[model samples]
Target: MPTLAHQQIHPHPHNKSAFAKHVILLLSTMMAGVLQASSATDQHYPIDVQSCDRIVTFDHAPKATVSNDVNLTEMMLALKLQDSMVGFTGVSGWKTLDPTLRNGIGELPELSPKYPSKEVLLGADADFYFAGWNYGMRVGGGVTPDTLDPLGIKVYELTESCIHIMDKPKVSMNDLYNDLLNLGRIFNVESRANTLVTGYKKELADFQAHLTPLPSPTKVFVYDSGEEQPFTSGRYGMPTALIEAAGGKNITDDVKKSWTQIGWESVIDRAPDVIIIVNYGDVTAQQKINFLRSNPAFSDIPAVKNNQFTVLEYVEATPGPRNIEAIKHLAKAFRAAL
Candidate 1:
């Protein structure tokens, strides 16, 4: 038997070129396989996203854009599409972000502490705008979809905030999941979206399984702000759904509105067992707590009397990926209080 080296050295003269051509073809086939695999890994583009009654087709994943508010910005980061964001605004809630999300957003440019002016947004030449109604961009602010769409900029509204413009209003986990799925589709990250939603569902199921059934739901009141008239989440708000998922009942669930300002007397009458204080803006959760503790009108309330309060960031209270964690935190708090 000839050695491998001897066989190569003593190859038939007529077969030398044929053997070389065969090697070349084999190499080319391997390279083609590698190239095809790489192409398959790339995101699919030209996605059509129908959200909030508007259909916007993304020819490709947006590469330059401005995202407003914590909810939208965080969603983009969670989807790993932060590279598409040219700039963003609304950093007041940045402190409340998940550490990984905070680090990811830390490198991005912040256009403003609040909503950016139309001039700034337009100047950025962003192809897309991820924002909410009053939360990120207000109507008549000169940055609405009607205005931006004409300028070749597409705007996607935060699902929770759509309650303001939609004919009917309600909040559910599906709202957050839909936003994530739609955003994933737009950016061609549907697999990531599915994985994220699956993880959330599993975590929710585990949490629910361990929960001890209560004779009746624990009454919860969500305090956002306002001293004269307290701002609370109603049936149509994300916080309401979160509270329910945590095995607590939103005392204001009967109110058809989203976030509504109600008389303190109304809150006093219901006397929630737990108070979820929204942490955001210049007003700290401590500030809200102090106001509740100082207010004589609230002294008799069960939540105030027992100091059964859970602090949720304004971002968590909104419809987004963080809502699952918010529900988990609330459930733990409710269990501990009971």
Candidate 2:
């Protein structure tokens, strides 16, 4: 065979025109993509969204926002909204900040180590507060919507926590998506938010598909904190949805509460095969595990007898980007029979 440099080669006239047309088509497609990307950031201004019972109107995108808690902050960071934020609150109070979260904040300060007081938020001059009831606010707490609105700070309540102040159905992953979608529209980053939500849904579905089916859905109990009475997640808590997604049942689902106390008798009656420990605060996870191990009351419980327990960090068990990975861990633990 002759080398190209030593041989004469000629393209047909139609072929040359076809190649030119292909180049023009490719360039036009590229230009269209560029225009679409730019348009994604365009805002109409004065958008209204129904968040829980409140009809929140955004005259303009908030310039200084503060997200409370580690998991909630992770959601904001996932959307790349860090530059628009003033800082965060509620991370250092109960749990230490891990390196991944610490670096995501970069130079941003932790405005308050615990639940920030209204004055702390005011001092930061935050124009928006990304928080939930009990996550960062109480039913009538000092840092609630009633207090923040007059201070010119817009509040978006986490959907899962809505059950605390209002009547709502059981928690689902859609609650997580709704939060991101609303935040996207509020920030004029709707395209980014939609893309992230879509990716998450697809990723979660894919994760569930690969999971080997157990003999049945594994029974799961979420042990948050308790010594005398157990404080745990119930029907409306994010863990209910997470446990269901991992092909397990949350034993506390019948309680009809979020993070609340339940009778120790109910826990013993349910007898979960697996116990998920939410690790945080002054009390160590091992200590909590040992408590269950040594207690004569729990001696007959299935999980206690088998010592089948998994630990999730405070952030992993809450609503955020980490939940999917947490589900994978849960599925493996739930289906360990294989």
Candidate 3:
């Protein structure tokens, strides 16, 4: 015969197991709370947690003359420092900008081809090179930081478009804001930069607050960069954020890479409500429209059929302070099309 304690326990073994399970659940809940608090703390003190190597400090402002590029050109315009631009290349979209704003900036010189030739760039005698993209450094074609560094010019790549290995951290709104703030600091305009940052944050917050709830989120197709093998802004890219904020679905949201190419058939099957066509260099809105219309595969798309197309000028669409303008434009266009 078993003892009284054993007999009592054996009769209700299930109760003991149930109690053990409750204890485990309570412990897990406590752990989860701790983790949540830790995450919150990290968010609160992000700067302190960031790696030291990721931080780049500038002691004094650089007198930067931007090469012909999209984002940097727009940033200069937003800052009203157009006088500082001495030399540039790629002049196709000069006419597309608001005529009022572009009044005094007449007949821009094609200082260089797609990438400025070494002779043309050197002739400009710039203090610093501010390039929008990394392709400026092609061998034998244009001047690069490595090529210009010897000639007493420092280069600062727009951190937003810094995709190369040697470039800065991943692009974000914070990165763009910080770059502007840093530029302000360098140029002895810290106060003005802070003011700009304040305005930008407020505008973004306002947009976030007024976002309309969708009955069914409209599918959107973003045609970025290339046409031969379509490049799209995937999970981490700016296009993904742009689509999400405007209350439309990014067709390529499922793609895990920063940018990816997809099949034309896939896009046709999904039948996106709106189409975004980005133009850089010599590519014009009319050219993109013509291509879409001429192509047998894409002529039947709902966006094309309905004429629901929004075109973004190079500088406005690039990730920078001008991004707010792009987002607003997209929202307006999406609403109008719907």
Candidate 4:
């Protein structure tokens, strides 16, 4: 017949110990859950990503994003971030979108046919910009990081293209891997990015393992564009990395430039065993090949003489998802030429 309040404060003797233990266990479980949630939250947000020489920090995944160029845009798509993108720029100005790329982009408007101004991005309400030096943002251009940052837009520079604005190590396929992983982190898609990169590494290794050791590496040239002098991929270009991985040597490896116009004389002097023509822009790949085949200047080049010209799309030549397939094509072509 004890009052209800008295029973609540002090249960029967036998039940008191049991009630205390129950209360302790309940509180302990609640505390552990709170601690676990805090750990997860700390690990994911406020991520810091290295963009060229700069470190950009993010508090949350960007809701509105824009990318430039087919290669960089393709990287975003590869991470399945299309839903976050408002639009893209830097295609159709110089390069045509192939069916695969065209479809990957779906209905996203081409914000600009070429490099867009800061106003264009701000108009789209973009929170993130994925581009690299000269790929979309030129040095001192209207759309540079400095110009856009004040507008609340963050930028992520392409690793391969960073050589344009900052001193970087020699180019490698790792450049491609880094971009994918870092983008994955920025967009909160780290798990997908890690898995894709792992598969790429294994695929590249498996292909290289099957390559027969050659007496000497095949001398290769990457022809991007330029009728006046021939814009070729040099030591720091992604094609150079691809060439090396395919068991071939880039004849321009000594040029000390990434992608630049070199004298046809330099190309003639080195005498490439194979020429990888980048397919893009106003001219067709065949026209580029025809130019080489018909020209007396290149008649004596080994690749020209043997008709060893291999065609790779602009996407394949640059750092992108197609790099592995491009390398495979090059390796087969190199051996066939040999």
Top lDDT model: 4
* Residue pairs clashing, model 1: none
Greater-lDDT candidate between 1 and 4 = 4
Q: Would you list the rank order by lDDT, best first?
A: 4, 2, 1, 3
Model 2, span 193-292: residue lDDT tens:
9999999999999988887888788888899998999889999998989899999999988888988998899989988999999999999899999999
Give lDDT: candidate 3, residue 293: 68
Task: For model 3, state the Cα shift of residue 229 in Å.
Answer: 3.5
Clash number by candidate, in order: 0, 0, 1, 0
Badly placed stretches (over 4 Å) of model 4 are 1-42
Screening candidate 3 with a backbone cut-off below 3 angstroms (N, C-alpha, C), the clashing residue pairs are 61-186
How many residue pairs of model 1 clash at the backbone?
A: 0
Model 2: how far residue 265 lies from native, Å? 0.9
Structural similarity to truth (TM-score) of each candidate: 0.86, 0.87, 0.68, 0.87
Which 10 consecutive positions of candidate 1 have the poorest summed lDDT? Answer: 92-101
Evaluate residue 148 in candidate 1 and report its C-alpha lDDT on the 0 to 100 scale: 83
Model 4 Cα lDDT, one tens digit per residue, 212-265: 877799999899887779999888899999999999999888876788998898
The lDDT per prediction is 0.83, 0.90, 0.63, 0.91
